[model samples]
Target: MSKLKVQWADQHEFHALLRRSEVEDKPVLLDLHSPECSGCVNHDRNIYSDPDIARDVMEYTFPVRVVTTDPDRASTDIINNHIYIWSPTIQLLAPDQTRHHEWNGAPRRTRLSVGYQTVFHDTPGHLTPDAFKAQFLVARGKAALRNKKYGKAIGLFDEAITRHPDDRVTVEEVSRWRKVAQDGGVIESTWDHQHQVTTSPLAAAVERFAQTVATLPDNVLMQDWIGKPGTGDWQWYSDCLREVVLQAYQELCNFAVTAERERARHGPRFNDTHRLLGQHRFAYREFQSLFIGVPDALLDQTPLRSERSIRENLAHMVMAEWWAYRPQILHALDRGRKGLPPQVVPATDTVAQHGEPPGSHESLHELLALYERLHLRNTQDFSGITDNELGIRSAWWELGPVELRFRLERYIWHPRDHAVSIDKILDASGHRHTANHRFAARLFSGLETAEAALIGTDGFLAGRVDSLMTTINERADEAARLLSQVTDIKPGIG
Candidate 1:
């Protein structure tokens, strides 16, 4: 009947609250939260202030708010041990500092200790107040179950079911708890409710293509196997080469499809990828807070902008430079295969003076389409390109004359190199140096190595293998180094 008042104490006053708890003979309900956490805000609106929930807080315990990220929060040691630096965690403690309803003398909540980020992590946003209430009741019921308070757990579960009949996840979870209580088995719980994400297409493609390139026979004489040009059939060599290129090209297509799907889920365009490295712009921009501590200001000033642009521009640049010379190269090779004159065919178009402008998904699609056309053409249009063709003089248009071999190598390596650069950019963006990122990088690299083994008996070149491993390690190291340079630390708004 009276206006509800919820008293909140900062963590710095935790000891005082402990003392006050003893004086008042009440337990303490500590809300350990991050200032920028969405779940914490939900607690303020739904859990802390709801008429029913607030009555429990006001009548039964001292409600204390601990912003774990705050520098002045008391007892850094305890705070670090008990509080999740990134999420909202609630702990009920007796006046003697022992936790209420603690099971197995577990020093940590399983979800908070091993998997808090996975469970409670969210981009800052509001949830339905009803959902929030349901979550609280579920959490309390879980605690009761853990403490062997079967009747209390069942009651709380029933209450949560009544409160959120529309929430299937909650309803199913409560039903499971009721079953566990009756059957007398261990209660298994997890905070995470979302499906796990697996290997992304672009990541798979890059690693697979790298493997293909690593297996190419280097410093080996292909001419000996092809035999005298006019006398011996070179179908074996041509077919093998086409197969290698086809694999690489197909992987690119796979990456494109995956990117398209991601675009559909995340929307056609978003700049939230940029905000993982900065403090602003995550208020509701999709995928913004996916990682933290990425330095966006550095990226915008450099060439490592949107990855789509780099892929697009490079695809155009490589196409324009190679397209003019491709016909001549193809014709000469075809002539040799057909037992015609092996006369030199001059390139009709000069090397491009400069790269084309930044590209888009549409531009990349165009390039892939062209590759599809070239790939599907009959082998009669192009064949008989022996190692001897490596000596043909050419320019990168920007760099001085490089051998034909180098140009072909560029076609493969350019995209691969850019993929590595993109990896570096993400590493620098945020969370790149973390265990999860490191694990993913290693998995991807391992897959690449495995695919490369399938390239040929030649095996991955020693240098190429080293390069792939080095890039993965170096990117993580560089990102950590850059993050170390950031000063004047601050937290985003709540």
Candidate 2:
């Protein structure tokens, strides 16, 4: 076995060769490799370096070695746009740049265009140089078949059959490839780009959002908020809570209404769901008690009882959103700006018990209106707040003293967890739950991102963002998959 000096074409030279090959009616072999790719390394050492393989390449085809990692724009563009090929792809092209064939990892011909056909071949590892040559002939035959040069392809297959006459599998594969080319209706091959699942922008954003949500607590009680409120810059949380927290609460309230309708239709399945909603309402009221006492803004009001109906739940939720949480947050800002301590303000018992009775469209409408009114008032009241007030701590409660950051975290997470529960209820009721998941996921993401921005580098919020983003990505990926399904979609590869 003698060594052959192989010429590798640079980008310009490769294109010049391609042009010449087109005019001469010759096939061009492209060895597309990535410098850092381990598979590419193995391919060079194990397959391309074989003495017989090198001899045939020099004699039979115009070989172009394209290192994709090269800074050459043309080479990178070709890899990106035409081949969609991964590293170590060995492709043979017709004179016209029509991709005739490509192989990597025991390659089989797959669909590139219509009218081409080929049979699968089994190329075992540890091939002798002659066996490698025989496989190359089969590869060439398939490439011809792909180019629709049926006569040339048949002749090539015949030659391959003669070369590997002792190997029944190779002979049968050649015969099959020829037969398919003869009866070509539509192109057929068994190959896919499973190694690459490109993430869309929507998928990426969703992922980032999920990761943010994953870091925040699913539900936070007053005790937890008071016990271990972490500190950092407070501006982002103030901004995010002012904007998104209200919207998230509203969406969850809407979802709860839908769940109620589902319960009505089915009867008892949503009982647990409604019960959970009621408990969350009650828990938040207790949470409100941590930051408010009598004689302050009436933002932190406690419900007299747990919600008992859909209408009651909605009413309480809206009330909590506006009067309790919003007021408490705004009050903290006011005191912080004034350089005063966090005021402990509680609503009068009369005001606390003033929840609207449930079980009517009228009550629901009134509650919604009240929510709007409260929103307008609180938004106006808290308009002057800046991030500087973020580190303000509430008076000592059941657990300990809690800051505005922890309060915002609990606010976002607590309702978010309930919203998730509502989604589960909707799913069990046989409804599309992707919307619910997407909403909660996005809400949590936004809140977490805001919180993380506030806390900066050393904040606990920062640590959780990466993992939360991974979770969001997984969720968004799943949502995309489910959404892409056709009504009567088939099970396998399209």
Candidate 3:
């Protein structure tokens, strides 16, 4: 057999292999276990896993692993090789192949196996050039960080520092990671720059702050900071941090889902849609401040439509606004007198629809044809109607007190509120956050042009008042006119 250098630990395999080697008349380096060894843990998982060490010790020393439980098995061979014994020991066989030399535990170091019944771990000893032991600690620390176990990562990194006292890398690594532990780190780069995300560390911190703002008696310290002011002072920063961002996000998700399902049955124009529709209704008022120019900012005038088409669509929006309040206005006229409203109320009485995009029909041709019919019918009907019809009012309020028309108008403000939100969403998405915040600009333009034509035809507003259905039909015609001019390019869009 060729000569080999050997390092060894353990007592179990040591006994087994040595006995076999002796019988085969081969050199056998039997590892011994004195009740006193200290650094064996380092050797097994780390050293044996290395290639150079595996090569040199291959042929000559039939290295056997051992523990105190089975010494006799290799005990015979151990004694035969003239192998020197030491507990938890490592020995090398001499080249003449019959003699042995031993390495006992270093001075003052205790045996590694003494009081540990846990997994046999090789406690690291100072490693030379390769940074073997310290490198393992570094890797372990990184893994801990990934699990969000900051405390564990810090400990591992600290231990690495102890092992490599002079390596500057240890200091830099720790400093960098400490920031992440405190502030938390999240991955955030534009994926070649398109979509935007705001729900990780940055947003988490914000949510945590928000929790503090929604405080209770339990938040004594936060309450104290705010004094008697309803905690307004604390809101500045406390409104943004998130202790557990994902948990809060799940709650919001649940709330949104529940609300959406309920809203679906309520018809379209729930909030923002309702508000924008109101602006359209107010579009024709001589008092421009009540409506027009409200959506100047946050608009994208880059669509394919021209100035006139926008006004016509906006005019239709006003008609929709009038129709939206029809049910409530009519109901106050009757006072829930009818048994109850039908379950699936048709769109004529509803403010919005959930199914299909606006203007959808079985075929594009069918839809276009319907628009054509409305255009022809609307002008003819408006021309034939008399001024007496204009002065007539449908049932909306009762004699007891408030009229349904005014009360419904009051709630119409709710829709207007949503118009603001919709505008913000649009502006933010389009990278135009600086405009006048006008969400109604495009519709306003369209409404103006549309109203001029409809009101100018034969009868004006004072002389053109008609039934809600007649109004809607006329509005639909206006919608068709504006839509036809839309040119496949919608401008002032979000």
How much does each candidate deviate from the true structure in C-alpha RMSD?
24.0, 27.2, 32.5
Pitting candidate 1 against candidate 2, the one with the higher lDDT is 2
Q: Cα lDDT of model 1 overall?
A: 0.41
**How well is each residue in 178-272 modelled by candidate 3, as lDDT tens digits?**
44444443322111101111122222222222222222112222222221111234233332112122222332333334434544654321343
Candidate number with greatest TM-score? 2
Q: Compared to the true structure, candidate 2 yields what TM-score?
A: 0.33
* Number of colliding residue pairs in model 3: 60
TM-score of each: 0.32, 0.33, 0.20
lDDT of 2: 0.43
Q: Considering summed lDDT, which 10 consecutive residues are worst modelled in model 3? A: 189-198
For 148-186, candidate 2 gives per-residue lDDT tens digits of 788887888788788779864456557656775676613
Among all candidates shown, the one with the greatest lDDT:
2
- TM-score-best of 1 and 3: 1
Candidate 3, residue 113: the lDDT equals: 33
lDDT of each: 0.41, 0.43, 0.34
What is the total number of backbone clashes in candidate 1?
2
Tens digits of per-residue lDDT for model 1 on 62-141? 87766645335263444554432221256666555544321111111112333232332323323455655565566567
